[model samples]
Target: MSLTRRGFLVGLPLLLAACSTRTTTTSTVSMISAYGPIADDRFPLPGLNARLIQPHLRRQEVDYESSHAKGSLVVDTPNKYLYYILGNNRAIRYGVGVGREGLALRGNAYVGRKAEWPSWTPTPNMLRRDPEANGPYRNGVPGGPNNPLGARALYLYRNGNDTMFRIHGTNQPQSIGLAMSSGCIRMLNHDIIDLYERVSSGARVLVIQA
Candidate 1:
């Protein structure tokens, strides 16, 4: 989703001040090749067929199992994707929307909490940064039709505290594979719903620099 000037002005500072700690380790890359039409069940659009077909989502790079990382979820930002490293040269890849240049991050964290069609509450810090986002504060945006945190949310936590950054779904399918959120990583809503069903709370996550 393209960030409007309003969205940018509202999100920039929250993105910048967002910070976290990391434990770095190397791991093998899993290269995914082309395949037939694959249905991304997590993407929830009205009438259009929701599948990640070739060219749009292709296997470019794969990290084989690197000893340094045993149990970790890897996110390759430059590729606009996230991978839950399984083993050997295999990983479950999902397309994602990351933070724009000035708002990127690399690190390790665990899913603190998981929510389905999560309510969005712009933080006090977010409001202080942009008063225009005032009314959208406090209340969680309900699940279903129009919420931005589409189908699910895996809250990233550091040192047992919520970091405010999330790996969630987007109502904006166009935003997938683009740096266009309020710094939260966005996925096709259907894809995220599928992922939410697969991942348990406390799953390990690794965001890597490309």
Candidate 2:
């Protein structure tokens, strides 16, 4: 079978996903895939550059002792990490890009909704902040690999009210682990896809400022 460029890059990682400790092989491979192009994504995510995921930032289980209950999602804005609470002082940590407005959108919220290859509509503030860049897309960008919200998105809400905040995959993978002008938490497309599978609807999300 002739593998397309996307297929070759995407398949290479799955073959290596089994290389780590057997217990962690699954997570390891998934993490590796996070940096490689995706041929199976609903919208054809182009994947990420190898160097984008620094060793320290790659998805892996870490000793994260938190008061948050299991199955919750936590965003560590200052450290640029997102944790999916797995209890037992352990969690799956994924590095993310936090916008300044995303930092301002702190406190408790829940995943009121989730979507795959979700469309993106920039908030008014986002437009005002960079009209030149966001103006043409005012009508909203459709769900696809090139969209701002890449493969998956988790919408944040409180008490059934829309908080207008989101955790989603990004077309701009290079922005991971940095602050940007947008108003959401952005992850590598593959990382978001991984997160989307692990999180359930209505999972609580806590964004920590410090």
Candidate 3:
């Protein structure tokens, strides 16, 4: 099931109210502290080299004034920013690599599922566009450090149908803030792992395209 723009707008208020009432016992400060510099052998994510990325593209907490309810995920395409609303006019912002011009998606969706080290299968359309690049992955690529989908994935859905779009980690950390994907939004592997742990399945996401 997919929702039209009108349908999503109609339900927006109700969704916001429901999300506002939910709260975690943990403090936002502590939560930020917990997500400290990512270092774990289990996933083997290499530390991000600051010199490789611009200062603005790095993950950081910022003062975000928005009408969206707490816990909602907002993607500002033009700014290359993804914000997780933390209430109190604050948000945890992560830099993202968005879809190249013609492939971008906008409007509302919810995270229908989540995965760790998710598999990647190139769609038929993707394979057709770049056979040499995507054809071999038609059967799917096993998840790992080198896989394009990286360490975590949050699958987006609208009206219960898979959008075939995702907020997932990428093997190429330097791609953050660039418009260079088929459609999926890409995050740093470390950042995605942190976001995956914080966001719940079914959380609302709003994408603003400019």
Highest-TM-score candidate: 3
Worst 10 residues of 2 by lDDT: 8-17
- The TM-score measured for candidate 2 stands at 0.80
> How many clashes (backbone atoms < 3 Å, residues ≥3 apart in a chain or on different chains) does model 3 have?
0
- Deviation (Å) of 121 in candidate 2: 1.6
Report backbone clashes per prediction.
19, 1, 0
Ranking by TM-score: 3, 2, 1
Name the 10 consecutive residues with the lowest summed lDDT in model 3. 5-14
User: What is the per-residue lDDT of model 3 for residues 87-200, given as tens digits with 9 covering 90 to 100?
Assistant: 887676777999999887799999999999998998777998899989878899998887899889999999999999999999887788999999999997767877887789
* Candidate of highest lDDT: 3
RMSD of each: 11.3, 7.5, 9.9
Q: Which ten residues in a row are the worst by lDDT in model 1?
A: 5-14
Residue-level lDDT for 70 in candidate 2: 94
TM-score winner, 2 or 3: 3
lDDT of 2 by residue, 1-210 (tens): 111221211111111111111123234444444556666655555546555466555666665656778999988787787888878766767779897743357889999999998988878887887899889999998898688888889999999998888999887777888888366899877778778888999899988785
| Shift of residue 102 alpha carbon in model 1, Å | 2.8
What is candidate 1's lDDT per residue for 62-176, written digit by digit as tens?
3344432444567778767666554664444566889877666578889899986677887666577677765555566667657777768889998999988899877777777
Which ranges in model 3 have alpha carbons more than 4 Å from their true place?
A: 1-41
Off by over 4 Å in 1: 1-65, 68-71, 133-138
